[model samples]
Target: MSIEVGSKLQGKVTGITKFGAFVELPGGSTGLVHISEVADNYVKDINEYLTVGDQVTVKVINVEKDGKIGLSIKKAKDNPKPSSNRRKSNTHSKGNQDRTETFEAKMNRFLKDSEDRLATLRKHTESKRGGRGAKKG
Candidate 1:
Protein backbone atom coordinates (compact mmCIF):
# COMPACT_ATOMS: atom_id res chain seq x y z
CA MET A 1 0.00 0.00 0.00
CA SER A 2 3.01 2.28 0.45
CA ILE A 3 3.66 2.18 -3.35
CA GLU A 4 7.40 1.93 -2.91
CA VAL A 5 9.67 1.15 -5.79
CA GLY A 6 10.31 -2.59 -6.47
CA SER A 7 7.12 -3.50 -4.65
CA LYS A 8 4.95 -5.99 -6.50
CA LEU A 9 1.22 -5.68 -6.02
CA GLN A 10 -2.04 -6.83 -7.53
CA GLY A 11 -3.88 -4.26 -9.59
CA LYS A 12 -6.83 -3.96 -11.92
CA VAL A 13 -6.63 -2.59 -15.41
CA THR A 14 -8.75 0.54 -15.22
CA GLY A 15 -8.06 1.78 -18.73
CA ILE A 16 -6.03 1.08 -21.83
CA THR A 17 -4.43 3.58 -24.16
CA LYS A 18 -2.26 3.70 -27.22
CA PHE A 19 0.87 4.26 -25.15
CA GLY A 20 0.16 2.29 -21.99
CA ALA A 21 -2.36 0.83 -19.58
CA PHE A 22 -3.66 2.41 -16.40
CA VAL A 23 -3.73 0.12 -13.36
CA GLU A 24 -5.56 0.82 -10.13
CA LEU A 25 -3.45 -0.23 -7.16
CA PRO A 26 -4.62 -1.39 -3.77
CA GLY A 27 -4.49 2.09 -2.24
CA GLY A 28 -6.60 3.42 -5.11
CA SER A 29 -3.50 4.94 -6.64
CA THR A 30 -3.27 4.51 -10.38
CA GLY A 31 -0.09 3.96 -12.36
CA LEU A 32 0.84 3.84 -16.01
CA VAL A 33 2.54 0.71 -17.36
CA HIS A 34 4.30 1.74 -20.51
CA ILE A 35 3.84 -0.45 -23.58
CA SER A 36 7.50 -1.37 -23.60
CA GLU A 37 7.11 -2.73 -20.07
CA VAL A 38 4.15 -4.86 -20.99
CA ALA A 39 6.17 -7.87 -22.06
CA ASP A 40 9.57 -9.17 -23.04
CA ASN A 41 8.53 -9.13 -26.69
CA TYR A 42 7.54 -6.27 -28.95
CA VAL A 43 4.00 -5.08 -28.15
CA LYS A 44 2.47 -3.23 -31.08
CA ASP A 45 -0.98 -3.49 -29.51
CA ILE A 46 -1.40 -3.22 -25.76
CA ASN A 47 -5.01 -4.36 -25.90
CA GLU A 48 -3.81 -7.82 -26.84
CA TYR A 49 -1.99 -8.15 -23.54
CA LEU A 50 -4.37 -6.28 -21.24
CA THR A 51 -7.93 -5.00 -21.09
CA VAL A 52 -10.19 -3.01 -18.84
CA GLY A 53 -11.19 -4.89 -15.66
CA ASP A 54 -8.44 -7.49 -16.03
CA GLN A 55 -6.38 -8.32 -12.94
CA VAL A 56 -2.62 -7.97 -13.21
CA THR A 57 0.45 -8.03 -11.04
CA VAL A 58 2.76 -5.10 -11.49
CA LYS A 59 6.03 -3.93 -10.06
CA VAL A 60 6.40 -0.35 -8.90
CA ILE A 61 9.35 0.89 -10.95
CA ASN A 62 9.10 4.57 -10.04
CA VAL A 63 7.15 7.01 -7.91
CA GLU A 64 7.38 10.70 -8.67
CA LYS A 65 7.00 13.46 -6.13
CA ASP A 66 4.05 14.83 -8.10
CA GLY A 67 2.21 11.54 -7.40
CA LYS A 68 2.99 9.91 -10.72
CA ILE A 69 3.71 6.19 -10.51
CA GLY A 70 5.46 4.06 -13.14
CA LEU A 71 4.60 0.39 -13.09
CA SER A 72 5.96 -2.62 -15.02
CA ILE A 73 3.95 -5.79 -15.58
CA LYS A 74 6.77 -7.93 -16.97
CA LYS A 75 9.15 -7.00 -14.21
CA ALA A 76 6.63 -8.11 -11.63
CA LYS A 77 7.31 -11.71 -12.58
CA ASP A 78 10.16 -13.42 -10.77
CA ASN A 79 13.44 -13.84 -12.56
CA PRO A 80 14.01 -17.47 -13.56
CA LYS A 81 17.67 -17.42 -12.60
CA PRO A 82 18.60 -18.74 -9.19
CA SER A 83 20.49 -16.30 -7.00
CA SER A 84 23.46 -18.60 -6.33
CA ASN A 85 23.88 -19.51 -9.98
CA ARG A 86 23.38 -15.93 -11.03
CA ARG A 87 26.17 -14.76 -8.74
CA LYS A 88 28.50 -17.41 -10.07
CA SER A 89 27.63 -16.50 -13.64
CA ASN A 90 28.31 -12.85 -12.89
CA THR A 91 31.89 -13.68 -11.98
CA HIS A 92 32.38 -15.18 -15.41
CA SER A 93 30.04 -12.82 -17.21
CA LYS A 94 32.77 -11.39 -19.41
CA GLY A 95 33.08 -14.68 -21.30
CA ASN A 96 29.52 -14.76 -22.62
CA GLN A 97 26.95 -12.49 -21.08
CA ASP A 98 23.24 -13.03 -21.63
CA ARG A 99 21.63 -9.96 -20.16
CA THR A 100 18.07 -8.80 -20.50
CA GLU A 101 17.70 -5.93 -22.91
CA THR A 102 16.29 -2.80 -21.33
CA PHE A 103 14.30 -0.33 -23.39
CA GLU A 104 17.09 2.26 -23.55
CA ALA A 105 19.61 -0.38 -24.59
CA LYS A 106 17.36 -1.56 -27.38
CA MET A 107 16.80 2.03 -28.56
CA ASN A 108 20.48 2.83 -28.61
CA ARG A 109 21.26 -0.37 -30.48
CA PHE A 110 18.54 0.38 -33.07
CA LEU A 111 19.86 3.91 -33.66
CA LYS A 112 23.39 2.70 -34.06
CA ASP A 113 22.38 0.01 -36.53
CA SER A 114 20.23 2.43 -38.50
CA GLU A 115 23.08 4.92 -38.85
CA ASP A 116 25.43 2.18 -39.97
CA ARG A 117 22.96 0.96 -42.57
CA LEU A 118 22.34 4.48 -43.90
CA ALA A 119 26.05 5.11 -44.19
CA THR A 120 26.48 1.89 -46.15
CA LEU A 121 23.59 2.79 -48.44
CA ARG A 122 25.01 6.28 -49.08
CA LYS A 123 28.39 4.86 -49.91
CA HIS A 124 26.89 2.37 -52.34
CA THR A 125 24.74 5.00 -54.10
CA GLU A 126 27.55 7.54 -54.25
CA SER A 127 29.63 5.11 -56.32
CA LYS A 128 26.75 4.76 -58.83
CA ARG A 129 26.66 8.58 -59.15
CA GLY A 130 30.34 8.61 -60.21
CA GLY A 131 31.61 9.46 -56.71
CA ARG A 132 31.14 12.65 -54.69
CA GLY A 133 31.37 16.14 -56.26
CA ALA A 134 31.27 14.70 -59.80
CA LYS A 135 29.22 16.51 -62.44
CA LYS A 136 27.75 15.42 -65.77
CA GLY A 137 30.16 15.69 -68.66
Candidate 2:
Protein backbone atom coordinates (compact mmCIF):
# COMPACT_ATOMS: atom_id res chain seq x y z
CA MET A 1 0.00 0.00 0.00
CA SER A 2 1.43 3.36 -1.06
CA ILE A 3 1.65 5.98 1.64
CA GLU A 4 0.56 9.58 1.07
CA VAL A 5 1.21 12.69 3.14
CA GLY A 6 -1.23 13.13 6.05
CA SER A 7 -2.18 9.45 5.90
CA LYS A 8 -2.16 7.58 9.19
CA LEU A 9 -1.03 3.93 9.26
CA GLN A 10 -0.13 1.16 11.63
CA GLY A 11 3.47 0.14 11.44
CA LYS A 12 6.13 -1.74 13.34
CA VAL A 13 9.39 -0.27 14.54
CA THR A 14 12.06 -2.05 12.52
CA GLY A 15 15.06 -0.19 13.91
CA ILE A 16 15.93 2.49 16.44
CA THR A 17 18.79 4.98 16.38
CA LYS A 18 19.89 8.00 18.40
CA PHE A 19 18.41 10.25 15.76
CA GLY A 20 15.18 8.41 14.93
CA ALA A 21 13.27 5.20 14.51
CA PHE A 22 12.61 3.21 11.31
CA VAL A 23 9.10 1.88 10.85
CA GLU A 24 7.95 -0.81 8.44
CA LEU A 25 4.67 0.16 6.80
CA PRO A 26 1.93 -2.06 5.43
CA GLY A 27 3.43 -2.53 1.98
CA GLY A 28 6.83 -3.50 3.40
CA SER A 29 8.08 0.03 2.85
CA THR A 30 10.10 1.63 5.59
CA GLY A 31 9.84 5.23 6.85
CA LEU A 32 11.83 7.36 9.28
CA VAL A 33 10.46 9.02 12.38
CA HIS A 34 12.78 11.89 13.21
CA ILE A 35 13.76 12.39 16.85
CA SER A 36 11.92 15.70 17.12
CA GLU A 37 8.74 14.11 15.75
CA VAL A 38 8.67 11.36 18.34
CA ALA A 39 6.81 13.25 21.05
CA ASP A 40 5.54 16.60 22.32
CA ASN A 41 8.20 16.89 25.04
CA TYR A 42 11.96 16.93 24.67
CA VAL A 43 13.33 13.47 23.91
CA LYS A 44 16.91 13.25 25.15
CA ASP A 45 17.02 9.58 24.16
CA ILE A 46 15.03 7.77 21.51
CA ASN A 47 15.25 4.54 23.49
CA GLU A 48 13.09 6.11 26.22
CA TYR A 49 10.12 6.11 23.85
CA LEU A 50 10.48 3.18 21.46
CA THR A 51 12.18 -0.10 20.76
CA VAL A 52 12.68 -2.35 17.77
CA GLY A 53 9.60 -4.44 16.84
CA ASP A 54 7.24 -2.13 18.75
CA GLN A 55 3.94 -1.45 16.95
CA VAL A 56 3.12 2.24 16.49
CA THR A 57 0.56 4.36 14.72
CA VAL A 58 2.33 7.02 12.68
CA LYS A 59 1.24 9.80 10.37
CA VAL A 60 2.92 10.22 7.00
CA ILE A 61 4.59 13.64 6.96
CA ASN A 62 6.33 13.54 3.61
CA VAL A 63 7.08 11.34 0.59
CA GLU A 64 10.26 12.11 -1.29
CA LYS A 65 10.73 11.69 -5.05
CA ASP A 66 13.09 8.80 -4.29
CA GLY A 67 10.19 7.01 -2.45
CA LYS A 68 11.60 7.81 1.01
CA ILE A 69 8.88 8.50 3.56
CA GLY A 70 8.91 10.73 6.64
CA LEU A 71 6.52 9.99 9.47
CA SER A 72 5.46 11.53 12.84
CA ILE A 73 4.39 9.51 15.87
CA LYS A 74 3.51 12.68 17.82
CA LYS A 75 0.94 13.93 15.34
CA ALA A 76 -0.73 10.56 15.22
CA LYS A 77 -1.56 10.85 18.94
CA ASP A 78 -4.24 13.03 20.49
CA ASN A 79 -3.52 16.38 22.14
CA PRO A 80 -1.45 16.02 25.26
CA LYS A 81 -2.55 17.19 28.68
CA PRO A 82 -1.13 20.46 29.97
CA SER A 83 0.94 20.45 33.16
CA SER A 84 -1.25 21.57 36.11
CA ASN A 85 1.65 22.92 38.15
CA ARG A 86 2.43 25.67 35.66
CA ARG A 87 -0.30 28.22 36.17
CA LYS A 88 0.11 31.85 35.17
CA SER A 89 -0.32 34.56 37.80
CA ASN A 90 -1.60 38.06 37.16
CA THR A 91 0.97 40.32 38.85
CA HIS A 92 -0.84 43.51 37.96
CA SER A 93 -3.86 43.75 40.22
CA LYS A 94 -6.95 45.43 38.69
CA GLY A 95 -7.03 48.46 41.00
CA ASN A 96 -3.33 48.61 41.92
CA GLN A 97 -2.02 50.26 38.75
CA ASP A 98 -3.13 52.12 35.66
CA ARG A 99 -4.34 49.69 33.01
CA THR A 100 -2.96 51.68 30.08
CA GLU A 101 -0.48 54.39 29.26
CA THR A 102 -0.81 57.07 26.56
CA PHE A 103 1.20 56.59 23.35
CA GLU A 104 3.19 59.77 24.08
CA ALA A 105 4.00 58.63 27.62
CA LYS A 106 5.24 55.25 26.34
CA MET A 107 7.38 56.84 23.65
CA ASN A 108 8.81 59.38 26.12
CA ARG A 109 9.72 56.62 28.58
CA PHE A 110 11.47 54.57 25.88
CA LEU A 111 13.38 57.58 24.58
CA LYS A 112 14.46 58.56 28.08
CA ASP A 113 15.70 55.04 28.82
CA SER A 114 17.61 54.94 25.50
CA GLU A 115 19.21 58.32 26.20
CA ASP A 116 20.27 57.24 29.68
CA ARG A 117 21.89 54.07 28.29
CA LEU A 118 23.71 56.08 25.60
CA ALA A 119 24.95 58.55 28.24
CA THR A 120 26.28 55.69 30.39
CA LEU A 121 28.09 54.14 27.40
CA ARG A 122 29.58 57.48 26.48
CA LYS A 123 30.84 57.96 30.05
CA HIS A 124 32.36 54.48 30.04
CA THR A 125 34.22 55.10 26.78
CA GLU A 126 35.44 58.49 27.96
CA SER A 127 36.72 56.97 31.22
CA LYS A 128 38.52 54.28 29.21
CA ARG A 129 40.21 57.01 27.15
CA GLY A 130 41.36 58.65 30.45
CA GLY A 131 39.64 61.94 29.40
CA ARG A 132 42.75 62.71 27.34
CA GLY A 133 42.62 64.56 24.03
CA ALA A 134 44.48 63.39 20.91
CA LYS A 135 48.19 64.30 21.05
CA LYS A 136 49.31 67.06 18.71
CA GLY A 137 52.78 66.11 17.48
Candidate 3:
Protein backbone atom coordinates (compact mmCIF):
# COMPACT_ATOMS: atom_id res chain seq x y z
CA MET A 1 0.00 0.00 0.00
CA SER A 2 1.13 3.53 -0.82
CA ILE A 3 1.73 5.83 2.13
CA GLU A 4 -0.05 9.19 1.96
CA VAL A 5 -0.62 12.05 4.34
CA GLY A 6 -3.30 11.25 6.97
CA SER A 7 -3.23 7.55 6.07
CA LYS A 8 -3.50 5.15 9.01
CA LEU A 9 -1.62 1.86 8.86
CA GLN A 10 -0.24 -0.95 10.95
CA GLY A 11 3.51 -1.23 11.15
CA LYS A 12 6.20 -3.12 13.01
CA VAL A 13 8.85 -1.43 15.14
CA THR A 14 12.13 -2.26 13.45
CA GLY A 15 14.37 -0.20 15.72
CA ILE A 16 14.23 2.10 18.74
CA THR A 17 16.40 5.15 19.45
CA LYS A 18 16.60 7.98 21.95
CA PHE A 19 14.81 10.35 19.56
CA GLY A 20 12.22 8.03 17.96
CA ALA A 21 11.23 4.56 16.83
CA PHE A 22 11.66 3.25 13.30
CA VAL A 23 8.52 1.56 11.94
CA GLU A 24 8.38 -0.54 8.81
CA LEU A 25 5.12 -0.02 6.93
CA PRO A 26 3.36 -2.52 4.73
CA GLY A 27 4.89 -1.29 1.46
CA GLY A 28 8.46 -1.96 2.64
CA SER A 29 8.72 1.72 3.53
CA THR A 30 10.14 2.85 6.86
CA GLY A 31 8.86 5.79 8.91
CA LEU A 32 10.08 7.47 12.09
CA VAL A 33 7.66 7.81 15.01
CA HIS A 34 9.03 10.70 17.07
CA ILE A 35 9.17 10.51 20.87
CA SER A 36 6.30 13.00 21.24
CA GLU A 37 4.14 10.87 18.94
CA VAL A 38 4.67 7.66 20.90
CA ALA A 39 2.06 8.31 23.60
CA ASP A 40 -0.43 10.75 25.13
CA ASN A 41 1.68 11.53 28.22
CA TYR A 42 5.35 12.57 28.44
CA VAL A 43 7.62 9.75 27.27
CA LYS A 44 10.94 10.10 29.13
CA ASP A 45 12.31 6.92 27.54
CA ILE A 46 11.03 5.51 24.27
CA ASN A 47 12.18 1.97 25.18
CA GLU A 48 9.75 1.97 28.15
CA TYR A 49 6.81 2.20 25.74
CA LEU A 50 7.98 0.23 22.68
CA THR A 51 10.72 -2.15 21.58
CA VAL A 52 11.92 -3.82 18.40
CA GLY A 53 9.33 -6.14 16.72
CA ASP A 54 6.29 -4.51 18.38
CA GLN A 55 3.37 -3.91 16.03
CA VAL A 56 1.36 -0.71 16.43
CA THR A 57 -1.12 1.44 14.52
CA VAL A 58 0.17 4.79 13.38
CA LYS A 59 -1.10 7.66 11.25
CA VAL A 60 0.95 9.23 8.49
CA ILE A 61 1.24 12.91 9.43
CA ASN A 62 3.43 13.87 6.54
CA VAL A 63 4.80 12.33 3.36
CA GLU A 64 7.44 14.79 2.27
CA LYS A 65 8.27 15.47 -1.36
CA ASP A 66 11.64 13.76 -0.78
CA GLY A 67 9.87 10.52 0.31
CA LYS A 68 10.28 11.07 4.04
CA ILE A 69 7.21 9.74 5.89
CA GLY A 70 6.46 11.21 9.32
CA LEU A 71 4.23 8.94 11.42
CA SER A 72 2.34 9.59 14.65
CA ILE A 73 0.82 7.13 17.11
CA LYS A 74 -0.44 9.75 19.58
CA LYS A 75 -2.54 11.73 17.10
CA ALA A 76 -4.21 8.54 15.88
CA LYS A 77 -5.43 7.71 19.41
CA ASP A 78 -6.06 11.23 20.72
CA ASN A 79 -9.82 11.41 20.20
CA PRO A 80 -11.45 8.03 20.87
CA LYS A 81 -15.16 8.99 20.73
CA PRO A 82 -17.55 11.66 21.92
CA SER A 83 -20.53 10.77 24.12
CA SER A 84 -24.03 12.27 23.63
CA ASN A 85 -24.43 13.08 27.35
CA ARG A 86 -21.02 14.77 27.41
CA ARG A 87 -22.00 17.44 24.92
CA LYS A 88 -21.58 21.08 26.00
CA SER A 89 -24.59 22.83 27.49
CA ASN A 90 -25.89 26.15 26.12
CA THR A 91 -28.08 27.24 29.03
CA HIS A 92 -26.89 30.18 31.13
CA SER A 93 -28.13 31.04 34.64
CA LYS A 94 -27.08 33.39 37.44
CA GLY A 95 -27.40 31.94 40.97
CA ASN A 96 -26.25 32.86 44.48
CA GLN A 97 -22.51 32.98 43.79
CA ASP A 98 -20.02 35.13 45.68
CA ARG A 99 -18.21 37.15 43.04
CA THR A 100 -17.52 40.27 45.10
CA GLU A 101 -14.51 40.77 47.35
CA THR A 102 -14.00 43.88 49.52
CA PHE A 103 -10.97 46.03 48.70
CA GLU A 104 -9.66 45.61 52.30
CA ALA A 105 -9.95 41.82 52.10
CA LYS A 106 -8.11 41.62 48.80
CA MET A 107 -5.29 43.95 49.90
CA ASN A 108 -4.91 42.15 53.23
CA ARG A 109 -4.56 38.73 51.64
CA PHE A 110 -2.14 39.97 48.98
CA LEU A 111 0.01 41.82 51.49
CA LYS A 112 0.16 38.83 53.84
CA ASP A 113 1.32 36.46 51.10
CA SER A 114 3.83 38.95 49.70
CA GLU A 115 5.27 39.66 53.14
CA ASP A 116 5.69 35.94 53.89
CA ARG A 117 7.56 35.32 50.63
CA LEU A 118 9.74 38.44 51.07
CA ALA A 119 10.63 37.41 54.62
CA THR A 120 11.70 33.94 53.43
CA LEU A 121 13.86 35.38 50.66
CA ARG A 122 15.41 37.97 52.98
CA LYS A 123 16.27 35.25 55.52
CA HIS A 124 17.98 33.18 52.85
CA THR A 125 20.01 36.12 51.51
CA GLU A 126 20.96 37.27 55.02
CA SER A 127 22.21 33.80 55.95
CA LYS A 128 24.46 33.73 52.89
CA ARG A 129 25.76 37.25 53.58
CA GLY A 130 26.21 36.52 57.31
CA GLY A 131 28.41 33.52 56.54
CA ARG A 132 30.75 35.69 54.42
CA GLY A 133 30.75 38.52 56.95
CA ALA A 134 31.69 36.17 59.83
CA LYS A 135 34.76 34.99 57.89
CA LYS A 136 35.95 38.62 57.52
CA GLY A 137 35.28 39.33 61.28
Number of the top lDDT candidate: 1
Q: Tell me the whole-model lDDT of each prediction, alpha carbons only.
A: 0.88, 0.84, 0.83
Model 1: runs farther than 4 Å from truth?
80-135
| Global local distance difference test of model 1 | 0.88
As a whole number from 0 to 100, the lDDT of residue 135 in candidate 1 is 59
Ranking by TM-score: 3, 1, 2
| Model 2 worst lDDT window (10 residues) | 82-91
Q: Which pairs clash inside model 3?
A: none
Q: Write the per-residue lDDT of candidate 1 for residues 22-68, one digit (tens) a residue.
A: 99999889999999899866699999999899999999999999999
Model 3, 1-137: lDDT tens digits are 87888888999999999999999999899999999889766689999999899999999999888888899998777584323222222111224323465778768868999999999998898898884566653
Clashes of each: 0, 0, 0
| Candidate 3 segments exceeding 4 Å error | 78-126, 131-137
- State residue 14's C-alpha deviation in candidate 1, in Å: 0.3
Per-residue lDDT, model 3, residue 52, is 97
Scored against the true structure, residue 21 in model 2 reaches a CA lDDT of: 100
| Lowest lDDT block of 10, candidate 1 | 80-89
Question: Considering only N, C-alpha and C atoms within 3 Å, which residue pairs clash in candidate 1?
Answer: none
